[model samples]
Target: MPSPFPITLFAAPNTLCQTLTLTHERELSALKKAHSTELQTLVARIENTSLSTPNISTTSRTSRDLKRKREEKPDQDRAS
Candidate 1:
């Protein structure tokens, strides 16, 4: 039975090296493309989730302003 992976018996060392290098390059390219696709899919999912969800901010500007005013009132009274 013929081997699934057949290297030409007459192929020179340099030729064999070049063939292996080319095969590795093709495999690397394929892996990079797959990784990029997965990353893009994850980003799209995250964007969709964010869009569907409401902003749950820790503190709103209005609330922060009110808190700051309340805090500064004591300083103002002390200064008077």
Candidate 2:
């Protein structure tokens, strides 16, 4: 059936638009109900994994050692 309102963008309630809205709402509600438990379980697993894992240091130990060597090099040359 043609739209009751002159323009498609108009917000006026039409049978076709109302039917489509109800159908979409029912589909979304069913999907949420079906997946809600699965989504919660997945989230819990992710949180547990993150908490159990140890934190890693971002700075490189090798860089610090190299810097110490460089600082000592000039002092050794002056003494010799």
Candidate 3:
């Protein structure tokens, strides 16, 4: 069968244009689905890792040694 419209027609409702639109829509939808799935997986991994960690304490024995070192800096500068 032949097209009812002339061969020069390039407007909407034409088979060539309609096919191109449908193909593009399908590709765009698939890309969106893939991006969402990847985002969800990364979020879950981060949540699990954060929950399994321990709290860091600032009042340990190492901190006391560092405090003594910091206080001696001004005295050493006066001698220089």
Ranking by lDDT: 1, 2, 3
Tens-digit lDDT string for candidate 2 (23-70): 999999999987997899999999999788654442456677789999
TM-score of each: 0.60, 0.36, 0.51
Against the true structure, whose TM-score is highest? Answer: 1
Whole-model lDDT values for every prediction: 0.91, 0.84, 0.82
How would you encode candidate 3's per-residue C-alpha lDDT over 1-80 as one tens digit per residue? 88888576566567878898899999999999999999999999989887775434544656877988899989999999
For candidate 3, which ten residues in a row score worst on lDDT? Answer: 53-62
Task: Give a tens-digit lDDT track for model 1, residues 23-77.
Answer: 9999999999999999999999999999887666734766888999999999999
Candidate whose lDDT is highest: 1
Clashing pairs in 2: none
Root-mean-square deviation of each candidate, in angstroms? Answer: 8.5, 8.2, 8.2
Better of 1 and 3 by TM-score: 1
Tell how far residue 70 is off in model 2, in angstroms.
Answer: 21
Which is the better candidate, 2 or 3, if ranked by TM-score?
Answer: 3
